[model samples]
Target: MLAITRSLPLRIPTRLFSTTPISLSGHSKWSTIKHDKAKNDAEKNKIANKFSNAIAVATKLGGSDPSHNVRLATAIENAQKNNVLKKVIEQAIKRGAGIGSEKKNVDTALYEGVGPGGVSFVVESLTDNKTRTIGLVRSAFTKAGGSLSPTLYQFDRRGLIVIEKGELTFDDIFEKVIEVGAEDLEEIEGEDFIEIITDPSDTGKIADELKKEFTIKEVGISYIPKEDMLVDISDEDTKIKYDKFIAALEEISDVTDYYSNLKNEE
Candidate 1:
């Protein structure tokens, strides 16, 4: 699945899965509370893990000083906005900075694979063990009847920045981003944010300029497919495999983000 940072105004054309539960009759009050709490805790842990990896990556990429590292500053800002604890943030920084015995080596890893229906994918993970991460990724693909292959050539690497719309109009952000040399600017209908695509080298410069007047929701390099491949989800077998593949990828904690060429068509 393509990971979209902000909500778009356009309605989604496809329903991957039904979120509504089929039955809730078997639950007691305490059981419900326990289930809810567990879900919430799991969500919180996922957020923490993502931010921790991001912070560590930013620090490793440009050192521990946020003042000198735009990516680090952005990562820290995003983490704080997500309510990640101060101590956790600091620990992540230390891990990246390689401070003391508590520090662990972390690296960014990428895996290229195919999903159900010949959908090409580029999966990114921030992990301490490449072997373990690759194993998990390969298993996901194999389970879905897909396989790892050379797929990076099917996409382009670009810097994608998502900015909150706030009180600004589409023209408002569009004009500003154009002035900053953004490659593309888009405001989808029904979305409350603007997306700006820029050259990898200009991401920090554009993001820094926008921060003075806009709320930056996300700033990172993303893989965009050269073309969209429509996958036939109407077939029961295809749909089942698609769901299975997506679930497997989601379960891998190290998999931070993924990009795919699969298109959901009406």
Candidate 2:
């Protein structure tokens, strides 16, 4: 159960919005993916739909209160960024929390499989109709020269928390985060945030501890690659094929996330 803090302020930095645990939605899966998913009108609509499901799911899992419910808070933030109407987000919360007659049977489904060139994929979806979602997702994979699998040994589901790069230096964050049991702290040079990776089970607890000081930009369960596949850019054919394949998968309305193990080094 989630409890919303009624009197505290927890506004996050604006630049911290991207990816997920990849969190909120599918904003920050990879820098390449982000660049591929430029926000046109169609992309914005896709984001809106994804966020609606995310908000509903977060509320159902935690509760409707954004303050106490980390997932819902993240969902709300990402949803607003995608131009999802405030009233719509509130309605989603209501439906998710079963607050009124406006109820929805939303559930999350994950498909682990391999995509083109043996790239591992963990497609996460929030759907009201699992049958339809599965068919479309599988079809997308099949068309992309891939097949569904029961397990994703190539991927490890982990807890990823992203905090904005505030006044605190890397050393400052490392000292504090390591004390609280973070597995690793990642600082990408020229990035606006530092990412902390934690054990999946301890995510909520550690996030709470960090919130005592840091403004959390995103937090959630993420399908991180056990080993990232290095894609050589000289192979333009492979890149083009994968890009088309990913676009097809993302076109499926229910497929809110497209997490892959392949990392095309820019």
TM-score of each: 0.82, 0.78
- The Cα error of candidate 1 at residue 128, in Å, is 1.5
Q: What are the per-residue Cα lDDT tens digits for candidate 2 across 1-266? A: 11111100122112224465434554555865656666555656666666776787778777788888886887788778766898888887886786776666777788877767776777888777899999998988898888897546766677778788799888988999999998887885588787788898888788888988888777777766554343233467777777777768757877656566666322
Which candidate number maximizes lDDT? 1
lDDT for model 2 comes to 0.70
Evaluated at residue 191, the lDDT of candidate 2 is 81
Winning candidate number (TM-score) = 1
- Return the TM-score for candidate 1, rounded to 2 decimals: 0.82
Against the true structure, candidate 2 reaches a TM-score of 0.78
- Which parts of model 1 are misplaced by more than 4 Å? 1-32, 228-232, 264-266
Whole-model lDDT per candidate: 0.76, 0.70
